[model samples]
Target chain A: MTNYHGQWLKLSPVAIIYFAVQFVKDVGNNLIYLLPAILVGYNQFSENGLVIISGLSALLLFVAISALLKFYFYQYRLTDGRVQIHSGVFQKNHIDLPFERIQNVRFEQPIFYRPTNHICMLLDTAGSSKLEAKIIALPKGVAESLKQEILSHKTEQVSNAENEQPEAEHEQILNSRSVQDLIIHGLASNRIWIVLGALAPFFNSLSEKFIAGIENLGVDVDALMASSQYAFWQYVLFFLSIAFIVIAFMALISVLGSVITFYDFKLTRSNDRYIRRNGFFTRHEVVMKLSRLQMIVYQQNWLDRVLQRVNLKFEQLGASLDRQSAGTSGGKIMVPSVTQGEANDLAADAWPENKLSAINYHPVSKRLAVRNTLIAFWLLIPLSGVLAYFGNGELAVASITLFILSTAFIILSWKRWGYAIDDNFIYLRKGLIGVNYRCFPIHKVQQTKLSQSWFMRRFKLCSVKLVLACGGQTLPFIKRTTGEKYIDTCLYQVEALRKSWM
Target chain B: MLADKFSNQSIKPDSLAKVSAQQFTPLSRAYVKVNLMCRLVFWLIVVSVLLVLYWQPWFPLPKMVALYLPQLQLAAGLFGLLSSTYGVIADKNKGYAIRQHDFSYRSGVIFKSVVSQPILRIQHVELKHGPVDRHFGLANLEIYSAGGSMHTFAIPGLPEEKARELRSYVLTHSDIAEND
Candidate 1:
């Protein structure tokens, strides 16, 4: 590994392809706006062949020129204790971050960079999490050396620095995901349904058009449905098969996503820092610092519970969890479909006191269940009353069943609310059917708030909210006195430790 | 489980120095006047704009809509006045305390909250004043910690000089922020 000696250098010319891919990915991510624009522009484009061709070419040329310009302007230099970046063609921006502030130096190898053996380096700062995300198209070996240089430089700063490089640099393979594990992870996650729900309106109109088209073909679909005299058992079997197919389809989509995104998922530890390497098309290698970690989230969905697997997320002290790395290249360290014991060990590595599997959690007050069920009771009246007024007994039964299920969910949610505290870490467990476990150090709490509504005040209940850098966690329906006690304890730890989490 | 070991400690909640909102100092009454004045000016402008829109001949409304324009304007005005009245009442309940170790602000008339940020977490302080606020010698002091924007809360209606003093105090006292 050779030093740059402060010489400013441009990236490999292959970076142009990386930029083009990035441009397409960015556009693909904004499909909501793009879809409508395409719809509105479709009529105009359909009117003329030449106009459509020219418009598409204009878009392509714009992307190409911009990508080329971006690559041309982007320059970087590695010097002692600092990394300088020169980028932004129009804006003419320059950024220099000290080694200590560069929280992570990750090596990313997108699909296009595969042939050339080049990697895109992502430098993450605590506050400006993604603005200075890329220093693209370095040779793979060069990127590795650069990462080591930054990490080692960071170690030489303060003696008690949280990111101090460990003595033995021997790398240890902490965990690896199998194909079966990946499939289980896919089966457990419900993101596909969420996407389907988002696209429901689009699908609704498309479905109506499709049905009209079929009617135009003289298929007599409604008559065909009326003519069929299927037996009750046959109908039940048909519905069960349909349910199985839908579930299988969902699993297929999720499994495909998991395969492409986390094909060879591995979590390895070296010199007190953790590195996650995975993805098929784009070989992603994310380095996570020992210091900046704020929370570990253990997730188990209903399917995951049956399969005895959990999704573990090692969160850092910056971006909120909603914008977490799933489809996007965010700094989310997720190891999905691991055994509970494995998840427990991974969590304990960061926070030694986080014995999540065996922690004795105190359940939230039962009044939560009572209050929620009572609140839900109001919906039952409307659910039945409106349909019953319309003289629909079947609809009434369905609504009644729905109400019962919702009540059960509310009770289960109340039962799931639990929290445990050790000397250093505060572990919170919550869910309905499936469970989620989150734990963070006491000192990581930036602020603690106690809030109460009028009804809660009357019931002597309140919610305690702990604000960490990554996100806020709320403990709802705790006793007012207990909420205050939590606030006191959290503030005491925060002030006493006075440690910088980021 | 370790829950059994803490059974003895459960007899009494650790009598930590109880920091309560009851100890908070009520905001200066001038905040009510300042807020009311701002609201009054706001509603006045809103009414004026509605009147202009109603009487303006360039873009005329349909007969049915025009017939009810005065009523709509009156409703909006009444609503704004009512909200201002509520705001005045809410201002009375707003209190703040700058303690030795932390800063606590108690707010919200209906959904009450007591938020405390440790001094060690204070990242930055901002004191802002608009034209109306300047005229009334008031400033809004916002303190932010090293977290999401939700971790920060704004304290509105501080006297200009007091706001400056508080800003200086926080800047000098936040040793952790300074180190960062």
Candidate 2:
């Protein structure tokens, strides 16, 4: 009677390394806040070399000892249809998780446990907004058996009408990213902007250090920059070359990051679940049940559009549902750099009746554009005039130019806003330079919100927000009649269908 | 048996009950007093905190407040009065209703909003009450769906017994819908 059956059990000794890695990861993620403390400690400890060395050793020893204690205290027992976990050295935690309550079960294999073939199993429950449980450093065979047991229990309890869907017992390859695809994804996605934004705080000191480094390398950087002999064209060429090098550097980093994170990325379908296997350093296997998937968001940035590739995000339940948090990194599976045909194929598989290729999209009311124009011109013109009156001619000119540019962009975005609802699914599309397509089953809608601002009410228009379990999507400035009609149909579907939207 | 009923049947959106047509049941009138009282208490605490910070030897706040004490007090008092008064007016527009297969809450004064959730989608419900709310015999019914961390909508100013009844009814209906 091992842990797999009726007896209590302990995690493998290798779990200490697992806990140690977790400690390092937490510290690294919080490095910004910890920087000041680290600097102060370093200043205080720098008086004596021996003290600093001993201080560092003491921290490491503490981490190691804590990890050991955590590993030793962790115990789990897998009984009939449930798993009871007893853990924690100080504040004890007891979790009795039933198989039916578990929404998802994913696995991770860190580099530390790779040699030993131990797995880290993460369980997510619908009741919790985050990962509810983690069973670290379990033998691969035991983990697999546990997963199967859970799956068996889950399948018996789902009660979804879609349970009769192609529950492929064998693994069927759905999608995979090639090395070229990964590279294209890196080049197309504006992940570099995010990295630069994070590093923006250090720019001033970084530039200073760079100049000093250049000086130390025997280059007369100041003199070269101060010289007036260089032609405008030559200076332009110098700046252009520097910009080119920087862009190339950013692209390199993006490509390396994409490769590392998406190495050997392969998505497979097995037993009504979409299994995603990826990661270079730490192999990750994420299993998303088909029935639990709320929606699929299809995105195309400028480069992605140019390359005729679309990135698809399969969204599930997440905590940040109310606010528009674009990149919260919750329950989602990202499939980047896929062809339109491939995207449609994936969409068709997820929701078979999805008309991704030939959706008859209806544009929003024209009053949206008129309203925006009125607001923009009435307010911006006066503001620009005030700036000019204050003798800031350049600022005024830029503001007017910006007004025109922004107006054009807004017009494009408004024109692209289209929505279509069929019997089963509803699709919403909006974009300025890049397109975003969101689609979900009509019945999967958790809630419907109709909002009318004072301006919108005057125009007989309303904003409709469809709140799904994954994330909410808002269709702004649509005719009130149309919005009501959509909501009515949506509600009718929800009432009539009674589909399990777990 | 459930699979047999699944179909791509055409639905007349016009025939279905329009969201705009549904009549909303307004909250208890006593809620306005409760709302005003809660805001008054909050503003009082804020004012007290500001006074403490300005008078106490915190080193930083005292000098700043000393220079603009009258202006700061006026601004806070004005904002508090305006906010509390607006809350009372807004509470008049707040209401909730349980329909055939869902629940709806209508709220806001200038910016009107109507939120509806399917009975089956509701994961849980709760009835909440503050001291002022209890004094007024008013309760807030919070309805949660299997979505975000936030409740779908929290309909406030319901009579206490009504709020409890709504919660229990919603929970029962949701369970039945789930098992249907």
State the DockQ of every prediction. 0.44, 0.63
Task: Provide the DockQ value for model 2.
Answer: 0.63
lDDT of 1 by residue, A329-394 (tens): 357688988998898898878777667778898888888888788777787858788889999989
Compute the lDDT of residue A233 as modeled in candidate 1.
78
Q: Give native contacts recovered, as a fraction, per prediction.
A: 0.71, 0.85
Q: Show model 2 residue runs off by greater than 4 Å.
A: A1-4, A35-51, A129-131, A157-168, A218-222, A319-330, A373-383, B1-10, B37-85, B174-180
| Per-residue lDDT of model 2, residues A1-502, tens digit only | 2436877889999999889878877778788777646654775667788977897899899889999999989998888888888889998988889888887788888878889999998877766443277888789998898888788676655445446443547999999999999999999998999979877877886788789889999998978888898877898999999999999999999999989889999989986789989988899898898887888889999899999999998987773643224322435788988999999999889888988677988899888888787788877888899999999999899889888987898799999899998768899999899999989899888899999988889989999999987768888888989899888888888877777787
Q: Per-residue CA lDDT of candidate 1, range B1-180, in tens? A: 222443334323376656673488778888898888779889989988889989898986899889988998999899889989999988988989877888888998889998888888877789998888888898999988877776676788999999999888887775544555
Q: Candidate 2 lDDT, tens digit per residue, B44-63?
A: 88877778767777476556
**TM-score, one value per model:** 0.88, 0.90
Off by over 4 Å in 1: A1-3, A30-32, A36-65, A160-166, A212-219, A228-243, A321-329, A378-405, B1-13, B44-78
